[model samples]
Target: MRPPTVLQGAPYPYRANSLNLFRLILAGTVLVAHSFYTTGNGEGPHIRGENLGGWAVAGFFVISGFLITRSRLRTSAGEYLLHRIVRIFPAFLVCLVVTAAVFGPVAMLMQYGSLAGYATTPVTPLQFVWSNITLYMNEYSIGRTLSDLPYRSVWNGSLWTLYYEFLCYVMVWLLGALAWFRRSAVLAVLAFVAATAAHALESVINVAGLDGDFLLFLKLAPFFLGGACVHFVIERWGVNPWIGAGAFVVTGALILGVPGWGGQASAPFMAYGLLWLATVVPQPRWIAVNDVSYGFYIYAWPVQQLLALGGLGIGGGALGLIVYNVAAVLLTFVFAWLSWRLIEHPAMSRIRRRVVVPSRTGSAAA
Candidate 1:
């Protein structure tokens, strides 16, 4: 394919992309990846030190970095935060409540004897209110819910990343408030350096004394910041398909060839690849109109666990896995669609209408 012409010195065209569909596909990727863990004998697929779910999470952070930065730039801080709150919390609160009150109690009754035990458990109410209220500080399970399942007690392992995602949002907002986004190129370079250094440090030194979650945040921060860097690159130099293609080849090679730090090394290239797909890939118009990705992402893990609890994958083999994943995907889609229609979209629309901002001059923010 011929390289698309570069459009330098122009505003970044965020709207001319299929990021919504891209995120949906990524969410589905996570579900598929987790299916191996949730189904059958619960022995997940071993893909040579790589996890598709990890990649999907990385993709999420990248997109969030790019889009949220743009969002913060175009609006007042209050409006920006309002948009973030509405976009994330309402649907999430619903999920938390349902999981804690409905699903948790049901699972507890199935596993134990009565709802009294669940009600008496402090973690139950704490899981519901604390997670929804704090946003990042999450409680995955409520009183032995999903305990009978193979994964055992973890209601939603997928949620840990949401904490980091929210952290990235706050970081972006802080940077924007500090005027770093206005000088995006300089900030991107610094962030890129910091990310690489952190990865290198982790790979070389024994940081065993450090908090595991903090260390993990250090590792994943690169992808998020690398995404922001890519946004700067696109804004400054524009999208050249040849550069993207070259990046893809180099990063793919690194991922395949390098040991230990290959994934971290490939963040920039992956960020670029995501941009290429977002901008250059042709997507169906329907994909652009309805965004069920967030719902799918937030709901899939619990749905998978519920299916497992229901004995959908007892056979312990490929057939069992296929059955479980198919069932999970179908049901998860239904929930996602319902969430979009009933909760997320309406909340966003209402919030947007209530909090009006000045019109931006350049391309529409994604």
Candidate 2:
């Protein structure tokens, strides 16, 4: 017998795809990758000059770009922006508070025997949370509490990406809202190609004298734009195995052979290949039912940091590494679950209920 293809009999339920589970795995990849360095093991592993965490972040951006572009087309600009903000900000805000109030205080307690003068310390807990309330991550530590950790003075190093992610959201918000762009998603495809070229030649571009400071944004733009391009292709072609396989091959070459900008340049192909895999995999029901990847992502670095302070993420020989990974994974999961149940889920639900998300197809990506 032949197997089914293209998912949901060619209707291709985007919301029903295994993205949730896939995202969770990406989050885990970041966690494990960070575990290497956060635990003082050096930058974990690398592919094409990117650490595992960097690769995972690229993965997140690729997927995110696809879905967000789809979203902008379906909703009013206001609705799109609102959903984006709500989706990212509430949980992020909570995570900041937890870091400043909970994680920092605990670390201080462990190191200094008290939280005395904690609030007044430079980069105080309030300052840490407030300064970064907008998600730019202006402050990385609270009251200098993390000064002793091997990763020193960085509370949640993972968070720097969130600012970039949100910036990408705004990029989609602006570009997708254009009347002409909305009418022709090929614009998205073109934009993606342009970005890909830029990144693929990043080295030559840098040598030619581009501003040094804009490198980080340039590093991520292609992937996000590629995801947008992938969304266009999926809507037009459905999910064919032939094209998907080809995409994977191209993605592999772009990511591995091209180093530096290779990962960024491979964004569209990578996203398409991942989408194809999502359709083929037998995903668990729980991940679909309760999306915890965001929670997991936001909480992972802190969980690792806490472990590092406890001597878990550091110098864990095979045995210690095993224990640290186990304990950190378990603890991060618990926090993620709580964050989803108590904070993220409820806040999103309230915003969703209060707002009528102008949907043309009556279906939305989760």
Candidate 3:
């Protein structure tokens, strides 16, 4: 039998990849990047005007696009939406509550040394929780807490992307209904191409001083669609190591050489490179088994805010940054762990139970 090549590949085991570990690392990268920003140190690093956090968030969308596309293709629309909702909503709602009730009071106490008048404050705890409950991020702060901090009054700045992420999910779901999109690899490639072009076009628009708030959608869509494109490529041809390497080379060139549109154009290559790395890189069993990336991503900002309120960040140098990060990670990991155990996993498990489908032998299996 002939060995599988890039054009015609062998079976790839989905579980063999180390995507979970990559996710955790990306989540940590966001935390580190925010450490610089929340402390007023500036965006830590940039490649072609995109900071580390921006890159990390793009990585997140890429990964999500790939996985969520597969998920949408594999299940009914109802099941797919259910899984997405359960995966996101429960933990998010609970995080809002904890931030409002627990972190808000804690920040108030740490900053003003009193919780007096916290309830009547504009955008109170209940209001904050209720407003952002639908993932629209209607409120960013609870009471006047953290208002004086560098980042200023935001409990979780990382949350603004959730709304966009869900919007992308809906786009994919809508596209998935078309048989041409589902069956034709060409369609996936076209989607990726169109998204990348829009991203580049938006970059050009910003350079011409026509930027607006809504352009963020164009900024993020390419990466997500890039992931979706890779999924189709994998399904049709296979995971090709050589193709992946060439993609990395392209990505590096676009990122380093091009000024305005380079990063935008590199979306497909970046997605492919990450996917390739997942295949080669090994993951720790603990991390592979239990994903705390979402929890960490959601909780890190508030934990850092609380630290700043306690007067930790903003003045000191490297040592201060290290201390702040160490403390934040430890505290935030505890919250993430609890969130996974108490909220995300349990909610997902209940959804899994409800997602019963017929087995090949004419029996129902969950």
Query: Which candidate number maximizes lDDT?
Result: 3
Evaluate all candidate structures by whole-model CA lDDT and list the values in order: 0.74, 0.81, 0.82
Candidate 2 segments exceeding 4 Å error: 1-9, 200-213, 353-362
Q: Against the correct fold, how does model 3 do in TM-score?
A: 0.91
Task: Report the poorest 10 consecutive residues by lDDT, candidate 1.
Answer: 2-11
lDDT of 2 by residue, 76-166 (tens): 7887888888889988999999998788889998888998989998888999989999988788877768678878888887888888888
Candidate 2 deviation (Cα RMSD): 3.7
RMSD values, in order shown: 3.7, 3.7, 3.5
Clashing pairs in 1: none
TM-score of 1: 0.87
lDDT by residue (117-169, candidate 3, tens digit) is 89889888989988888888878978889989889989998998888898888
Per-model TM-score, in order, reads 0.87, 0.91, 0.91
Q: Deviation in angstroms for 173 in model 2?
A: 1.3
Order of the predicted models by lDDT, top scorer first: 3, 2, 1
Which parts of model 1 have CA positions greater than 4 angstroms off? 1-13, 40-48, 109-116, 125-128, 203-209, 353-362
